[model samples]
Target: MKAVKWFAPHDMRLVEVPKPAPKPHEALIRIESTGVCGSDMHYYTDGRIGKTIITEPLILGHEYAGIVESVGADANPALVGKRVAVEPGIPCLKCEHCLRGRYNVCTTLQFPGGPPYDGALAEYSAVHAAFCFPVPDAITAAEAAMIEPLAVALHTIELAHLMPGETVAILGLGPIGLLTAQVARLAGAGRILGTDLLGYRVDVAKRYGVDAAYNAQTIDSVETILRETNGRGVDLAIDCARSTLTPAIACRVARPAGRCILTGISGEEYGQFPVDIARRKELTITWCRRFRFNFQTAIDLVASGRIDVRSLITHSFPLEQSRDAFELVSRAGENVLKTSVDQ
Candidate 1:
């Protein structure tokens, strides 16, 4: 089998490697599509995201979809020949968190593309069979692969505990932020305001879900959002960008006693927040860890045509061109939105 392995920052090469066999509870998936994500860029450009450093050459993809070529002895035989979106994280079911149904934070969770465990930027991946959710024929492989990010967006909106017709401000109009905006609307948010350092993202977001957006590079995003809300700030603020400042900015953009969800991975160990602002406002702050039990909801949303995940897939690359794909995402070049590596 062939896989792209990251040797250093900005260095990913296609290398021949031994094909993996499915473990007793795993299924061997012939990877069809893998979405390049901003979190992946953290490792691709800097070889780490906060404390999860890449110490060895590792295959780097998690947002993926594939066909189940085979299943292990204990795995579901019914899954064979199914086209599915494979969830990357496999948690120890016996853990206290898993027993409580919060498996996203299971203490022994093994997330591929992180380190040590190999990922799906390859010809095949062996993920737990239970984690592979089959998509309907109407869903393309690229869109199925997009389910991972959409799941994150769903989890973000769910954390907001939003009331119908409440206002929302999404910081960092990248794929996740844009998806968050769409999910917020579906959840009945009144108005959506978004900000991004790149103008291209801001423009693309308006078409996706944002009612109003601004280029933070040229404008003061906090002031602008406050002004848009008539100096009251937004009712709910979600941070889904790579900028560390977004955590604090979200606090400032949110109204007093409102909620703020920190969903972005800024790739830093310690991030600074506005302590006084959050304290005075008595804001409710929640940090989103990947997702939990949201895949089925995401699949339903995309399959029902309620969410447009396909339009956000602006670029696609072959397995051999994985490096170029990463570079494009790193530079945010060519008005690129979400990119997928396909067979």
Candidate 2:
């Protein structure tokens, strides 16, 4: 099997490795496509995100899809030959969180692409069969891979608890932020405002459900959003920016008692926000772990054309160019939104 392995910062190589056989409850998938995510960038550049450090060569791609080549003895044989999107995280079903159906936060969760777990950035991956979701033939493999991030956006909205006609402000125009905007629009959010450090993303935000967006680097994002609401802040504010500062900005830009959801992975263990401001406003600050109970919804949205995942897939590369794919996504230059490494 051929795999892209990350040795150190900015160092990646396609190397040959032994193919993994499926465990009793696992399935061997012939990976078709994998998407580079923001969290992967952190590992590519610094070999770490907070305490989850990559001390050894690791394969970094969690957003992925493929066809089930075969299943283990205990695995479902129906999945064989089926194209599916596999959720990269495997939680211990015996854990309290998992028992409560909040498995995304299972303390002993095993997530691929994170440290100590080889991801689906190769020609083959053996994953737990239960996490795999079969998709309709209408969507491509790349779109199936996109279901991971779409699920994340869905989780963000679930945390936001958005109400119809409520205002929203997304503190970044990246893929997750853009997807969140789309979901918010579907939830009937009014006057969706977005801000991004990059001008290209801000320019494209309107196409993805943002009513108005601007370059935060060129102006005060909080001020503009506050003014946009006539001195009141948005009803729900989401932070999807790379900077940890965006969380504080989300709090500042949210109306009193409004909700602020932090979905951004800033690579920092500790983040600071205006505690006084958050306290005074009585804001509800929630941190999103990842997606839970949303993969089917995401797949349905994309399949129904309600959410266009194709628009964000601005770049694609072959398996041999995995390094190039990471580089392009890291730089995010030339209007790059999402990069998919296809087999």
Candidate 3:
């Protein structure tokens, strides 16, 4: 097997390694496609995301999809030829969080491509069979890889508890942000507004059907959205930029008693908030972790053509070009939305 391994900041190498054999409850997957995620960029560029530092050589890809090459005795034999999206996090099902159906927050969760566990930036990966969601024939390998981020978008919208026809403001136009906006629209949100620091991203968002898209660097996003909304503010605001300022902007642009969800992970351990404004507005603020129980919904959305996950894929590279892919994603090159690595 060949794997793309990260050793230090900006250091990655494709090297040969022994193929992995699955345990009784796992499946050996021949990875077909992998999405270079924001978290992967964090580890590649900074060598860590918050406290999850890369202290040793690590494979860095989680948003991935592949075919089942083989399965352990306990795994279903029917999955051998199935195309599936790999769910990268394994949680302790015995935890209170897992018991409550909030397994994403399980205290003992083990996420691949983070620290200790190696990921699927290789020719093969062996994951628990239960974590693999079958991809419909209608979805491409790239779109299948995208189900991971789409799941995040789905979870964020679910947390927002958006009502039909309610206005939504998505503060970021990255892959997740763009997906969030589209998912909100599909989920019955009216007048979706999207913002990004990059003009190209804003343009892309507009093309993706956001009712309005703004280049935050050139305009006061909050002002523009509020002005358009008749100064009433949007019913829901979601921040996907991981910018220190965007959360406060989310708080400011949400109507009184409206909801705000922070779905991005900031580099800083803590961020400042507009306490006075948020308090006065009585906003219901919440944060989104990765995702839980949304993979099937994400797949169905894309497979059914209700969501266009493929349009967001702006770049693709072979496994050997993993480093270049990471660089493009980290720099946020012109018009780039999502970058995928084909194994």
**Better candidate by lDDT, 1 or 2:** 1
Residues 206-269 of candidate 2 have per-residue lDDT tens digits of 9999999989889999889999999899999999988879999999999999999999999999
- Compared with the true structure, what per-residue lDDT tens digits does model 1 show for residues 1-343? 9999999999999999999999999999999999999999999999998888999999999999999999999999999999999887999999899999999999789998988788889999998999999999999999999999999999998888988999999999988998999899999999999999998888888887799999999999999999999999999999999978999999999999989999999999999999999999999999999899999999999999999999999999999999999999999999999999999
Among all candidates shown, the one with the greatest lDDT: 1
Candidate 3 overall Cα lDDT vs. reference?
0.90
lDDT of each: 0.94, 0.93, 0.90
| lDDT-sorted candidate list, best first | 1, 2, 3
Give the TM-score of each candidate.
0.99, 0.99, 0.97
